[model samples]
Target: MSLALEFVSTVRADRSGPVDTLADVDGLTSWARAHAAGPGFTASEEARQETVRLRQAVRALFARAVAPEPPSRADLPDLPPFKEALALVNATALAAPTAPQLSWDDKPVLVIAPAAETDEPTRLRARLATAAVEFLAGPEVALLRTCPAPRCVLYFVKEHPRQEWCSTACGNRARAARHYREHKK
Candidate 1:
């Protein structure tokens, strides 16, 4: 499978870790180019800047998903358009317990937006934040998780039933640390 596919797959999986808001955008565009899925998406420097703006949005969504006190709609910024989009989506999700369906595959697919095309930083932030909330409401949104590795902020799904850390590197490091402690005794 392509890196984009892997990125999507990982996002849709179950695990606890910090969400990798934009790490896979370049890889995804690369894979999209290789697979001939139209021209590769070249995220402009503006997009990169937008991604930075989206960090707070994504983080806020994660906070809503895992944190106790989530921001209220009233607490949202004064930006009009993105906030409106967020309200629309958020209200829809709130009204419907089930996630919005996207693909027609055998398995249920929940639609979520990527931060790549957001033109306005404020709007992008709103979309990502809204998307995160929408994702959190879904039955399949176990996608939002924290890395089990002690200090690692990277997030990924728990592919295996017993998987924990976002990557095997973190898992190995943890295991090695355990071994060192035992052997030193």
Candidate 2:
């Protein structure tokens, strides 16, 4: 999965209700660490808010990317307008500028990386937004699907011809619900 997809998975629809995994500084810190490809970060109050805003924007865009298909239930109430979401992600991605550098030992490979002096929070947001933009434009967007299990609010890239729900647990939940409905009827 792309970093953007994992970032969006931070929010989930649980049995109790919708859950914002990045609900506070601690949550944000852990999520950043887990997702960080370069270096880990501890989120600040302002950083948390900004990160959440970016997440919302990405989710909103993802909702549209999977158009004609229902979006994650967790994102339903918080999705921003398509244009607004686009602007937010683009701005965030541009906030901390990156430059391309070539690294070669055996072969030459160029990498686009954020400026060294950029703060942790800003770098985090930029990386996330960049990943989201790439993911949305990439071919995998055609494979994204929102899980249909009872109370599921997760999206997944269909891995195979037969894949359905986002996870085994969600598939089980959906099966159970279908069984219950059939038996009840």
Which run of 10 residues does model 2 get worst, by summed lDDT? 34-43
Candidate 1 C-alpha lDDT tens digits along 1-185: 22212322322222463333344557434433444234634555565444444443443444345434322222135223455444544543343232344775898777844433433333333443445564556654454455545545443445777886668877887788778889995
Q: lDDT tens string, model 2, 72-122?
A: 888688788989999999999988899998999999999976666788899
| Model 1 ranges with Cα > 4 A deviation | 1-40, 67-134, 159-161
Backbone clash pairs for candidate 1 read: 14-158, 16-145, 16-146, 16-147, 17-145, 17-146, 17-147
> Candidate 2 regions off by >4 Å?
37-40, 104-109
Q: What TM-score do all the candidates reach, one by one?
A: 0.44, 0.92
Worst 10 residues of 1 by lDDT: 4-13
